[model samples]
Target: MKFTEGMWRLREGIRIDWMNNVERLRVENENVELLLNKFQRHRGDTLNSATVTASVTSPLEGIIGVKLVHWAGQVDNGPHYQLASSSGHTKINHEKTETLSYDSGALNLAINTAPNELDFVFSGAKGKLTGHSWRSIGYVGDQTTEKSQWDDGIFFERQGYMLAALDLGVGEKLYGLGERFGPLVKNGQTVDIWNEDGGTSSELAYKNIPFYVSSKGYGVFVNHPGKVSFELQSERTTRVNISVPGEELEYFIIYGETLKEVISRYTALTGRPSLVPSWSYNLWLTTSFTTNYDEQTVTGFLDGFRDRDIPLGVFHFDSFWMKSYQWCDFEFDEELFPDAGGYLKRLRERDLKISVWINPYVGQASPLFQEGKKNGYFIKRTDGSVWQWDLWQAGMAVVDFTNPDACTWFSNHMQRLMDLGVDTFKTDFAERIPYKNIQYHDGSDPARMHNYYTLLFNKVVYEAMISRYGKSNSLLFARSSCPGGQVYPVHWGGDCESTYEAMAESLRGGLSLMLSGYIFWASDIGGFEGTPPPALYKRWVQFGLLSSHSRLHGSSSFRVPWIYGEDCSDVLRDCVKRKILLTPYLLAEALAGYNEGTPVMRPMFLEFPEDLNTYPLDTQYMFGSNLLVAPVFTDEGTVTFYVPHTPEDSQGKWVSWFDHSKTYEPGQWYTETHGFDTLPILIRPGSVTPINPKLKAPQDDALNGLEVLVNGSLANDMAVQVVNPSKTHNVLKVIKIESQSGNVTADDAGVKVVRIGH
Candidate 1:
């Protein structure tokens, strides 16, 4: 994706025709065609012919979309993110002589038709709104007209870009672009918005969203689902440049007073996350990958936890629960789970829910394969051959989510599973949908559907679950997703290794995805790939249990605590208890996420945008707005975090929830070390944090006492949304409390707790 070498030359076969002047401009309906020249004077210059077309489409109110196209007539059906929020098209009046202007959402686009200049002046906070330059236009190579180009181009997408390289001060950093594990601040690296299966080590990401938040207080979302390459002061030392191949490049320039506001507006435009059940936040045990387990093994694990007084809420059966190479058969491996239905009933009797792992692949060995093939449920080539591959399973064919019948056929199996007490689904493998030479029943462009396919696939399964169960009761341990996939509830960092580095990288990825509007995120506790050291397992357990959805899963090993050591049970028990106690507070934050489109787990910038020190600090994140969680990634059990010294109002008081530790002043950096038994969870001034003392299952009544922790100098007020015990995500009560003295009065109106000293 890089076209330039260093600061001067082009890299190898890269040819960039930087447009200097717009020689000729033609307007036809909603399209504007431009003929450009690299130098100045040009009548019919064939040096680098770039014909650019800008199609104006408003997908949502207060937003204008100008999709720039370079090559015409290569409209292929492929994978593309579906933008569903465009509306209210105001008439665009063009001034004579090609000088045209249109305004929307305080953004003014002034076009100098003759000079081929398109300037977007965002009327941001005072004079802080940014603008795009002239050299930002121009498309990449031609789109292939060949029929087989769909699958090959899944890794790439067409784009249009305008770039600026601003200096990152001596300590300037970046954060927020949907759960990334690279540098939290993307100032010194090159990033690509392409989803991959690479674990949290290299730059490759499983959920590569085309968005980034800079510490400089602005976010740029390249509105493309394919591949978008960003050089964050990497190639150009002074600027961040993004390049996408194709006839069109579209990105948004968002500005706000703080990074949180930027997220507010971004999620408003993309999609807000949903509120998951309170129990979903509790500890989840899984039959880890490659581990031998049956009903007896599962019962033994459950019994061990019960004997230890560890409350296990959800039990997930990994891929092996189904017959080998017969994935998605929707039939539990009878050899292993002889009575899946009866076992589920037993789990329900124990007040535990069950979840199963499934992908969209329809293996030939699966009984549903023939039904899908006969009913056109799978994607097919132009030759009418079902697209089959042996990557994960033998003759695995992808279900054509674009086909209504295919979705119905797939949903039916899940619906039946629900009838048998399957509560949730781990919707996996959506990132690997085959695009090339495949045909969708809806006649969708295959290339545009690769990334978008994840949405429909998840939606089909998610909707079926919701319809059969209830909306509030629906959840998915989904792996792959696009922009709007936030509609699904919970997602985990896919396929992590058993190591501290991978654990840290998983945190980075989760933080990045959280920025991209995902409300919930979890990773395999103690990693998913290799056998983790006991130290690593204990550390990962603390981190995972603290997350929105905690699950102990692995690829080739069992994640039962005793397998690591007897001490491991103590670690898991401690974290699980803390999570249960904090469920009252976490669920309230989730409700706010439902309303605000923000993440319960947030990067540093989302909390303190003005504090440049926290921008690149991805090692630590805020569980909600109040508490800061810095996961220990080393054997030393040491964590280094920066707390924005906020000036206390009238009363100077800051308290630590773990221990009523000390009072710290505002506006300074603190390097506080913690033991494996604790992490830095600072409570802000004038905040109320809710803790359920009952500490039963997450869904148990939270109305009694509801020990609201009042951390130092509580000035303003705080609120807690009392979760309904009977119904998931339903608020039985919204308590607004004000704490000044020993007595606390519940505010007449509701409030969200801010227990941290910010």
Candidate 2:
């Protein structure tokens, strides 16, 4: 992806023809088309070589879109991300002597029209955020005449790359590239938007979205489902370079005065996160992958949670639920689950939702493989044969979701499982899709389909659930995603080791995901690859309980509390109980996500955008607009965190939710010591957090008795919305907790107000 060794010279075999000047501009009704030439001396200078044409349009209010093309022979096949609007209402005008400008709502774009120069600047309400200048746009190619070792014909086609470099300002930072596990700041990183199955330890990401927001108050979204190579201050120190392998590249420049607004607009253009079931916010227990478990082991684990008084919502069955090497047969292993229907009935009778793991793979050992191949349900190679590989399963073929009958075939299998009482599907492992010589059913671009396949894969299962159970009851435990994948509810961090470091990395990934328009995210509680020690297990329990969704899972060992130590049971119980108690509050935040595109687990910068300190801080995050959760990530239980504040905001107070007697002022760093049972959870100032302390199950209709905790002074009246299990908020009965005046009242309801720090 990097084309240069350093600033001075290009890397070997790389040839770039940069866009030097705009030769002529043609104005249209909604857009402007510009023909670009490399040389500006004479008309005949545009002889035997390359030329570029750019189409500028606006897809939404305050969003500028530019599509640059170098060749016309590329096919229009697509697995394109569904844009909410193709184009917005636009206005265009030009000055006679110098420039041509386009305005869409508050965003404005101006292009300098001088003979030998091409400068495009994007400005929001405040001023110019970023722009393209000089030789920033380019058509790149690898001119290696040597034959490819894999195939001689492969090198004959001169596949070109389209690249654009947007100017970056001094001290500007970049964030959000779809659940990255590396640094929170994206500078000095070469990020390629390619989905891979590599675990959380590596640069490969399961969800690689081609969009990023800058600290300079704008966002750039590469409008390609294919791989987008980004050099964020790496190849070029002062610019963020974006490149895609194709004849054309298109990108959208969205402007917002605040970063939160930027995310809102971006989500509006792509898709907003769907509202998941409220019960999904509760604790989930899984049959750990690769662990020896049968009906007895499963019943014992459920009974163990009941015996310990832990409130569990959903129980998941991992890959071993199906017969070995026969995944996607969608049948429970007969030896392990002889009475699959009756066993699921018993679990449902116990008020537990059932989730089973499923991928889009049809293994050759299974009967579904032949059915899929015969019906053209599997992805095919160019030679008209089903593509098979031995990576995860022997002779596995990926299901081609582009085929309608294939989708129907897969959905019917899921519906059969639903008839057996499976509540949700953990849609997993589409990140390893093959790209070489692949042929989709609908002739989609294979490069684009590599990442977009997960979107369609999750969508097929999600829609099946919705068709069966209705939207309110639908949810998915997806492992891979793309830009529009937020339409599905929940995604988990993939394959992390059982360590505190892995836990921290998981949090970083989750926070990064939230910034990328994903509302809900979870991870393996005791980690996925190995068993965590008692200390790490207990700490992870607390952290996971606070997340939007929690699941106890492991790779080789069962994640039951007793496996670590006896005390872990208590830690797990307390956290699960607390999570259940906070369900009303959490579900309200989930509603906020659906309505506003705000992430429930928000990074600190989203909450406190004016404070520069919060930009790179990923250790702590705000759980909704209130509660700040600083997860304890070390063995010693020592913690350090910062509370952001400006001059006018310094007078506010941060009250500790765990220790009522402890309070801290804003705008300073604080350190503390604690046991495994406690971490730093602080309620922000001017907020009213509703708590349902006596709830035993997440689905219980227990909003009748509510305890409101008022933090600091609510300069204005604070109202907390109580929503039911359904999507509707109970607007008739409102709870008002008056601050600066210790008066609290409810609209003829049983609500109690407790003042924490007045």
Candidate 3:
């Protein structure tokens, strides 16, 4: 994707035609069109050169889109991200002699139309955000050379690419390129927005979204389904270079007053995350992959949890539930469980929901494979044969989701599992799609469908679950995702190692995904690759139980807490009980994520954007708007975290949630050692956190024993809304508390209130 050798020269066989000057500009009803050509000194200089056409329009009130086309004749086949747009009005001002401006809400795009000055500057009410200037827009071509090799091992006569570079200001950092694991900040990195099945310790990502929010109160979304390569200050040091294949490239500039507002506008254009069921917020135990497990093993795991006094919510069956080499058949191995339906019914009687693993693949050994191959339900080659690969399964063929019959065929199989009392699905492995020499039934571009296949794969399964269960009950533990995939809730970090480094990497990935508009995220509890040490397992349990969703899954080994030690089970029970008590506060944060695009596990910068210290701190995060959670990554239980200062706090102080008497000054770093049961969970000043002390499960009535923990002094009156566990956006009751002479008093007579840091 890199075309330049340095600043002065291009690489071999590379040709770039940059947009130099605007020859003509036309405005029609808030839409601006520009006909740009290369730098011309005379009339005959424009005879044989190519011209670029640019269109600018407002999709929503606070967003502006720009589409640049090198060749306008290519047909846009299909497989586009579903985006929502409003018919927002904009103001056009071309009367000025030097600049032509378009205003959408408070965001303004001013184009310098002075003779040879072709610059596009985006500004807000505060100041300028970012812009494009000289040599920023170009059409690149790679002619065949000795070393010219394209992505798919095929060399073309001339491959075309369109690129645009935006300015990166001093001290500005970029974040959220979709579940990245390298670092929180994306500067000085070469990121390719292509989905892969790579694990958490590399630069490759399972989810690759082409949207990034900046520290300058703005964000940019590249609207391309295929691979979009970004050189974030890596190539040119002061620019974000984005290049995509084919004839056209489109991008949107979203502006907001804060980082959270930028995410709100971005998700409004794509889709909001759906609210999951309350029981899903509790603990989930799964059969480890590649481990020898029958009904007895699963039963023993469940019994162990109950005997240890730990609350269990759901039980999941991994891939071995099906026969070997016959996935997507959706049948339990009769050898393993002779009475599959009866066993599921018995588990359901235990007040537990069931989840099963499934993927969009049909091995040749499966009976459905022959049925699909004959009915044209699988992806086919150009010769009309079903495409086959022997990677994960023998002779595995991908289900063609482009055909409506194929989708129905796949969903019917899932419904069979649902009929057996299966409550949800763990949709896995859509990232290894074959993009070469294969064709979709709908004739979508193969490279584009590679990343988009995850959406179709999850959408089919999610809709099937919604048909069986209601909206609030349907959930998917998905792995791969794209731009519009946030509508399906609860994705997890895939295939991490069993080490402390991987645990921190998983947190970084989850925080990155949350910033990308995803609401709920989880990771493999004790890691997925190896046997975790007892200290590592106990530490991970505390971190995992505090996440939006918690699951214990691994490969080749069991993830039962007692396998480590007896102390591990006790630590896990303590964490699970604490999470059950904190359900009222967690559900309220989830409602904010469902209504707006606020993340439940958000980075520190999202809350304190004014503090410079919060931008570089990815080791800790805000669990909600009020509480800060710093997970203990070290086995020794020593953790150092920073408490941020905000303008609203009269006395800059934060109170510890574990011990109410312990307080810390803001804008200072503190290091503390904790046992297996505690970490640094700090409550923000002047905030009310609701807790249900008597709840046994997350689905219990929150109003039964609700108590509001008031931190520091309340300067103003506030109301705490206790969300209903069974319904979405339903608030059971509001507890109004007034600040009387710096003392907190609740209006509801029966509600108990506790004041901290008095």
Clashes of each: 48, 0, 0
User: Which candidate comes out best when scored by TM-score?
Assistant: 3
* Candidate 3 segments whose C-alpha is farther than 4 A from its true place: 145-157, 741-747
Per-model TM-score, in order, reads: 0.89, 0.97, 0.98
Decide which is better by lDDT, 1 or 3.
Answer: 3
**Which lDDT tens digits does candidate 1 get at residues 236-282?**
66556777655567776555566666666677777777666666887
lDDT of 1: 0.72
lDDT by residue (1-758, candidate 3, tens digit) is 78888888999888998888888889987799988888878888789767789999988889999999999998877689998887757998985437889898989999987766789999998889999988888999887553455664553446789989999999999999999998999999999999999999999999999999999999999999999999999998989999998888999999999989899999999998899999999999999899999999889988899888999999999999999999979999999999999999999988899999999999999999999999999999988999998998899999999999999999998898899899999999899999989899999989999999999999998999999898988899999999989999889999999999999999999999998989899999999999999999999999998899999999989999999999999999999999999999999999989888999999999999989999988889999898899999998999999999866775847899888889989889999999887899999987888999999999998988988888867777888888999985698888887766333343576777888874
Weakest lDDT window of 10 consecutive positions for candidate 1: 157-166
Candidate No. with top lDDT: 3
Q: Which 10 successive residues of model 3 have the least lDDT summed? A: 739-748
lDDT of candidate 2 over 530-598, digit per residue (tens):
779899999899899999999998989999998888899999999998888887788778777887789
Q: How many backbone clashes does candidate 1 have?
A: 48
